[model samples]
Target: MQPNFFIILSPAALEDLPATYMTSFFLPREEKRFLNRLLSEFPAITVIEIDAIVEQIQSIVDRVTQAVELVLALVVASGCLVLIASIQASRDARMREHALVRTLGGARSLIRGSLAAEFAVLGAFSGLVAVVGAEVTVALLQSQIFELPANAHPWLWLLGPIVGAGLILAVGLAGTRRLVSSPPILVLRGTQ
Candidate 1:
């Protein structure tokens, strides 16, 4: 359909304002012929293909998503290194504490359970914080960056604590295995 507009605006009011005027055409078929005719009639008019523009936008979004994923991977790796370092730094303290516990009539099984519980609690708390951060990040990325509806990952809430606790427990137990197995006398002697 051909559309026309007759605007009567005085030039003095908007003389300094730069404006872009666009005319849209709706066609059932023969769009190429129509565009060619329109272009031939108006050579100064610029024609932009909506489909091409959309493709370019999608390509940009894909690249951005990849970049975000890479950043997330780096962040995870950094967190892992920090966790290991902190555990290593506290190794001596943990050994001494275990020795003291043994001296105070704590059984090996009791020590193991307490250690497991501590690690699990730490992991769960961290996981909760991580989940909260993740959810906020997701919400911001979706609504602000990606221009999409915010998603609340309910399943993530359920899984985060369990996964965190399991991972921390496993790592903590592995790092402290020798501390539990060794006699308190040896550990106490080393600390001296």
Candidate 2:
């Protein structure tokens, strides 16, 4: 029976053989034609090309990349869902505090703005810490592992805070819209 797989012999090893051998070379697009001609003429020769092997490897890489992207999407979606759930869980306490502020003569818009600003500041601070940690980690990896120069992107530091703040503010407000809009009396009375 024919084996399901075959071991590939290196060119160096094959060249050491003590028998007469024939080699054929073909241009890029003439591989199939040459392969067909050889199969018809010799009936036992095998054909393979560097380009074909490289193409197969590239296809595998593309599949792995697609799988990584799908996993990343799932992780991000789950993180957002967790964030929303946590905010919802804290709604009652947040409403009580907001009610107290309102009862103490704070304007409704002021309370909402303050909460948004607070979340944004927290996000910005967290982003700054994250950037610092990432910079240090990358620096270590580059210098020790890869033996490369450490590169820093100043724009990333600047943009990180803004992006973090904007995202947190948007998500926080979206998740707490009801708590932010309800009047102090209704919130205190637990009527809405």
Candidate 3:
């Protein structure tokens, strides 16, 4: 019986078919000459390659990647700004604690190190919560809305806390630059 529709076959697989009804031609480094001859001989035949289809898929993937990166950058920028504002707002309380530490003869390095460690811990805690929340949300969406199998990314567990701590430390330190530079007495005098 005649086939209902023609199945596209790869050029590489042409050799696998029997030579009775199927005609296989090989023209080394003369694809243009071969195509010209084939079309002239059988102008009604159609030849299609998967390259165009694969290129379309690749283009879609690239666009998705770019959109994801843009979104991630916006989120990180906004998070940093929020972090900076929070730290700056709590500056008075921090200054009082630092002044107390200084009165107790705490060294400059000690105070700075303590602040850095505190911020790092805060960041790690925040990251841990965020990761857990995100994982749960994604799992729910996958199982309920999308009806797909949900999988966890193990790297997120490790990376999230580390990145969070680093970002918090960086932004917190930058926000408290004035407090870091000023003497405790000066800060206590309300002139800072």
* Best candidate according to TM-score: 3
Q: How many angstroms is residue 77 displaced in model 1 relative to the true structure, after the best TM-score fit?
A: 2.3
CA lDDT, candidate 1, residue 158: 88
Q: Which candidate has the highest lDDT of all?
A: 1
Q: Residues 43-161, candidate 2, lDDT per residue (tens digit)?
A: 76666676788899999989998997899569546756777898889888999999999899988898889889888996687668767876998799899998999999798899878
- Candidate 2 Cα deviation (angstroms), residue 102: 2.0
Number of the candidate with higher lDDT, 1 or 3: 1
> Residue-wise lDDT of candidate 1 within 1-192, one digit each (tens)?
133666678989788988767766555444667878888998988987766678999999899999989997797667666777777798788888988999999999999999899989988987888899999988998999989999899999989898888877887788778878878898889953
- Ranked by lDDT, the better of candidates 1 and 2 is 1
Clashes of each: 0, 0, 0
lDDT of each: 0.84, 0.80, 0.80
Model 2 spans > 4 angstroms off:
1-26, 42-46, 121-165
lDDT of 2: 0.80
**RMSD (CA, angstroms), candidate 1:** 6.4
Compose the digit string of candidate 3's lDDT tens values, residues 1-192.
Answer: 234567678888887776434343444544556777877998877644345567998999899989978997898899899988888799898887888788788887888898799889988987887789879988998999989999997888999899889988888877877776678788778876
Q: What is the number of residue pairs that collide in model 1?
A: 0
